[model samples]
Target: MTKKKSARQLRGQLMLQIAAGRFFRPGFPLNETEHRYTVYSNAWFIGDPPIALPVGEVVASTEMGHISSAMIAIVDRLEQQRPDGTDDFVIATGGTDLVDDLAYLMSFALNRTVSRNHDQTRRLVTGDGAPRGRSANDLFPELFEPRQTVQPGQWDDLRGFMKDLLSLSRDDFARVMRVIRNSVDATRRAPDDPTGAYTDLVAALESVSDDKLSTSVTWDRYDGSKRTIIDAALIDAGQEVADRVRAAVLEAERSGLKRRFISSTLARLSPDYYRDDAAGSIRPPRAPDLERMLGIAYDIRSRRSHVLEDLGEGVWLFTDGAETAYEPSFERVLTLAGLWRLIRHVVRRYVINAEKVAPEPWDYREALPGIVEMQLAPQYWIWQVGGLTAETATRRLNGFAEALIGWIAGQHSDGLPLDQVCQEIEGLVPTLPDGEARTSLIATHVLWHAWVDPTDHRPEASTFIDEYKAVLDAPSTSAFTVSLLSNHPMPTWSADDWVAMAQSRNDTRHTKSQAPLPAVVDALIQLFTADELELAGRHDEAVAFAANAVTELPGNEALVGWEARLVAGDHDPDFDVRTFLFGERKREVSEEPSGHEQSGEPSTEQNEAVTVEP
Candidate 1:
């Protein structure tokens, strides 16, 4: 009833066929073409080693189900292994010839031929195993032009970036591969079809951009308002008309392809293009010009897709060293080369940002000194510690503060460049686990060093005070002590920020915990804490907090001044508060205990239950 299939069908396995141009020149130990290099975990081989090809021939093959699958795996592996954007090995893959075991056996028996025809695989059997004098380079000169030769030691460097590329997710890997394919297509098609090449480059960008569109409806209010007004006007209209109108209004708010394309491009476009640069030439366009240029390109692509409009041939000629020529379609047209550059810039930035690469330990060591020098002035220096957790940051806080104190105190010169002497502080910050809280704490410490360095060439008191006030105005310093010290109202302060600051201060004071700051800075911050309490109409709490501060720093002029203000009900102090707050005061330590250290609670002893005189 049933017919038996031949043994060939039962034990079927296909040998992989591959013909790819070598992207890099050989300068390493394996320079001889006889050695078949195993790559991709030996999934494929380059050159025939076991059975060496005849002179002037090369081989790279594997076993796989299909040629497309095998080629995709090889190409993706090569793309991932590329060290930099400039290098593209595996330049172009040629036609594949699949030969099964039975076919191989039959061919071997007949004439020692395993392939359908030996000549079909001759592309892989070419002279020298290089693309020079080959049709690949002739067709895709743009790729060949920037090809890099792999020197002996540099092969490792070529493999180095693969670690980063390998970290991509399934979706990201696919997206990147798609981009590489489209980019290659663009280059290959550029000579024959400028329009296709341009569209391909733009399509490569759009592939990533499709997922980049903001999900939040940016025109929600406009859509709602228009719908409300139109609905009011259409109250008497039929239900069907009203439903159609509502649907139209709702659909208008959804983000479209053009907006997504432009929005993602602008978001990822390098800031250098926005600077004052050359005009009407190879130099990148300014921001407005770039936006307009991208918009025009997008429109042209749309027209090409929908209406079969071709990008004028002038674009190719102009980009290929031809002189200035005007196309009436655009006043400032971006050449194909310019568009590719912009696309490359955006795509690379996107990839790097997506990678979210952690700052290497050495990166911090090298960059901290320069960052300190630049932000040594009163600006907030946010350390970029990618993906570090808050708990790790909190754990490392004390060590970081102690390190800064030692670094600042260790300076010898009358304050050598504050940043230079304190440069190591920044290095220590990133070494601590990165987190929002960690970065905020680092910013607070750096600002404190800038304000009160033992090194004398630092910002003057007035300047430092003004800068500190400015920082508080923005409220970025999230360290517990600094927030309590500068407890003034922030213009954009959220209630949660205030609550967190208040709770942190309460906890510290309740346990009489040792302050992270120097004694003087700690005492001054305590005084400000009392001032904040007073301002909040907590008069008793204000007096108690200030009285406790007096206990902490007995003879400090600022603390004494705060107590005197409480006693005299002098909310509007006649004295120079700045002088009282910032003037040089020697540390006058009293041997007499203030009757508070014995208990682990704030001293409730107040001079008077006085409120600020209104």
Candidate 2:
């Protein structure tokens, strides 16, 4: 018999077991690492078949692409926090409400075109160190001309800083977070009483396995502070002082946030910590070393500092030594480290013995009505598809494109030029800062059109679709290829077999390329113009450009027939493309060719037509 499957062994399959209520949980002693692995795996996993595009081709996603892009952009922003001891970076003049959303932040941060001295952006005011209108919220927000400021220095234009940040890629976020994640392992340790709970907290707080995490954690010597968090975590006052710790764990249960429960409990014991509306804020606990460490952590998280200097190793010295070198970002990380230790202690002391109430993940679904009520931008696709690679993300985009194009086509607007509807899809994506991410985005755009438009001559649009098939067919295609690393550098696949494989690749792009419905419609117009050119000199012969097309699926039968007849038209090669496609429109499709129509003899001379950008 297979030894009962562990949560790790089942992978995402464990969810089904839980749903069925017929599963044996993996045996205990699960460490924090394993616990984390299980938690995240269940929370973020997406296990289902790929979705088909609205046009019956497979792309991905439904309508939530914008949210994902925003999330990814935010992640990118957070990852930029410096991992060094120096705290200096782009610090805003403190207003977070207007500073939400990744794309908005990125775009706002990166914009250099705006003048910094403008009335709206200038920081210093007349007669004092304040905003001209007292706050950014007030109207007529002007500042004294720069020359009149008390402290002659530049301040960050919060909006401008965000705009600049947008144009970059945050691939480092994943890598750095992965490193932080590794330091946090888990075990499903059974709940015990408060005995040794404080010691456990101390051990947990000091338990960062990697020195790299605390690299930036230092304090100012000149500031007259006590000890840094590291010193507190590692402090040892001897075994004889065991009685000094909390005599017993707070016997409590019945909870909302454990945050509220713990803070309220700690309130009765250490009133200063929860003093007068200062609930959840930090205050020192003088009883034990573990308690002291928790206080240092609470202070760093709330006050954003570690007042004391860190001596070598985990020791502290009270001398007026070197100048303080504190980094708030580092302090935040230190706070988290300390908090995790406190969490371990709380879990063992109070949470373990309390009635085990498993989390209900789907409870958030109750907020869907409210969630959908918010206004969201449509452009960024980062967060919605961050978990996916370039290929999958593009496919999701393709699905969006399909929905858009189908909506347009269903309107069935007669005589409307494809160009008229193509406004939504104009420019391809620019080379975003650093990655192969855009590779599949562009490639899928071309393929999405190839499938949607019945008359895109593959030969003339060579500039836009050079060896696209080869790229599509490459075994290594993925979301990363959209990055700058390897996708653009791919050597041209000139081999005939590679070329042949990619030739029909449009039939299977993993996503929608977010190209506009009108763009494909307009491309057909250009193809019609091109057909006029290809058959220009031959007016006395049958028109048939795609007559030789090997595969003739009934899906676009009418379009194929129209294209073949136009190409093989026996009319003058100078035949007007617009007139032929619109004025003399005949949409009746046929399985076999409309028995060859007479056309002018094929000629070598080509004629100039209007230039249109695809």
- Per-prediction TM-score, please? 0.31, 0.19
* Cα-based lDDT for every prediction: 0.41, 0.26
The alpha-carbon lDDT assigned to residue 557 of candidate 1 equals 67
Stretches > 4 Å off in candidate 1 = 1-161, 210-254, 272-281, 321-326, 355-614
Tell me, by TM-score, which candidate is best.
1
Per-residue lDDT over 1-614 for candidate 2, one digit per residue giving the tens place of the 0 to 100 score: 22433323222221211221122122311111100000000011122322111111111122231111111101011111223423323322111111112212212122111111223223212213432222211111111122211111111333222222221122211122222222222111101211122233333333322222111111332112433443354367454343232111111111222323334323223333224323332321223333333334443333322344322211111111111122343321112222332332332222222233332222111111111122121111211322344334344344334333332333222121122111111233342332334554554444334433435433434444553444444422331122111123433333333223222232333245432222333233223333443444533222322332213223444445555556555333343433322334423222111111224322222211221111
Tens-digit lDDT string for candidate 1 (1-614): 22433322221111111111122223311111111222211112222333221111213344431110111112211121233334433322221211222222211111111233333222222212543333222322222232212132322322332233334432353355456546644654565466777787777878778434533333333345565788788899999987776666545533667667777887876665444212333444556566556667788788888998996655555333211224567666666656655655565566667753321111011111111112121111112133234443332333333333323333211111223313333444445554444454454444445444335433443343443334344423244334433233323444444434444544565574333333444444445556666667667766765776676678876567758788567753233433443344412222111112222332222211221110
> How does residue 326 of candidate 2 score in lDDT?
26
Cα deviation of 469, candidate 1, in Å: 92
